[model samples]
Each structure stands twice: as C-alpha cells, then as structure tokens.
Target: MDWIVITVLFFILGLSAILIIGTLVSLPQVGDERKNLIKMKAQSYTFAVAMGYVLIQLFKNIYNGSNEGINPFTFLITISIIYLISLLFFRKKYGS
Candidate 1:
C-alpha cells in the first residue's frame, strides 16, 4: 500500500478518535450553557470543514490529475460518525 494512503488514513482516524473521546469524556464536567456553545461551535465547524472537503474533491475530480488523491468516502464516513457521536454525547449531557 502507498505510504501516502496510510498516512492519510492515520491522520483522519487519529483526529476523529481523539475528538470523539475528548468530547465524550469532558461532557460531564462542562456546564449546560458551555456545553450548548461547544456543541453549536463543533457541529458548525465540522459541517463547514466537511463541506469544504467535498467541494475540493468535486473540483479535483473535474480537474483530473496534478492533485489526484484517494476517494474521500472514507473520510466522509469517519467525519459523519465522529460528528454524530459528538452531537449525541452533547445532547445527552445538556438534556437536548
């Protein structure tokens, strides 16, 4: 397998895992108002970044080569799972 592929997978998995774990573990210690703020900020940023990635992928596909890379489906799935878990964890804590 390509080292680039390995590196990308590791990067995505490590960051998503850390974010999910940190959010879940810290929820109990955060106040309700702060939790709400955190949730809003996280969800918005996650969505924005994910969308930006999708747009980049779109253009990459259209451009063909020069910046060729792996399909982003895996990244999308990882992002969705992490963001969903974060939202659920926050809702459970904040009574949303």
Candidate 2:
C-alpha cells in the first residue's frame, strides 16, 4: 500500500479510537433502561462517524501520494480535526 493510504488508514483508526474513547468517557454512571438507551445511541453515532471517516479516507487515498511512516502525533492531530468537524456537523443533527 502507498504511504498516503497508510496515512489515511492511520487517521481512520485514530478517529475510531477517539469515538470509542469519547463514548466510554461520556457514558452515564447510572444503570437503567434510560442509561442503556443513551449508551446505545452514543455507540451508534460513534460507529457511524468512524465508518464515515474510513470511507472518506479510502477515497482520498486514490489521488494522493503515499505518506508512509508519518509521525503518530501528526496523524493524531489530523484525526482530532476530523473528529471535531464531524461533531460540529452531527451534534445538532443527532441532538447530542
């Protein structure tokens, strides 16, 4: 695989990590039906966003040059940016 594809994969994985972490951190402490529903919604949204990021990156890799062996920190920063953008756009739509 090209470096660009590798970089995009890194970003997608990082985004997925962020989503899972976010859901874990935000989950309510209480246990009940309401909490269960809330947790499911959070998980669903996180999964959806993560998948979207991966799909988007797959397309981007087609035209971009390979970006092999890029720094993790750089990949993380880009992941954060994409996560924030998705949050901003989806927050209202999902009413989270």
Question: Per-prediction TM-score, please?
Answer: 0.49, 0.40
Q: For residues 26-81, what per-residue lDDT tens digits would candidate 1 score against the true structure?
A: 66554767666667866986788778877888788778756666566587656767
Worst lDDT 10-window in candidate 1: 87-96
Which number leads on lDDT?
1
> Can you tell me which runs of candidate 2 are displaced by over 4 Å?
1-31, 65-96
> Residue 46 in model 2: shift from native, Å?
1.1
Residue 48 lDDT in candidate 2: 74
TM-score, predicted candidate 1 vs. hidden true structure: 0.49
Which candidate comes out best when scored by TM-score? 1
After superposition on all C-alphas, the RMSD of every candidate to the true structure, in Å, is 6.8, 8.4
lDDT over C-alpha atoms for residue 22 of model 1:
67
Which residue pairs collide in model 1, if any? Answer: none
Question: Which pairs of residues have clashing backbones in candidate 2?
Answer: 3-66, 3-67, 3-68, 4-66, 4-67
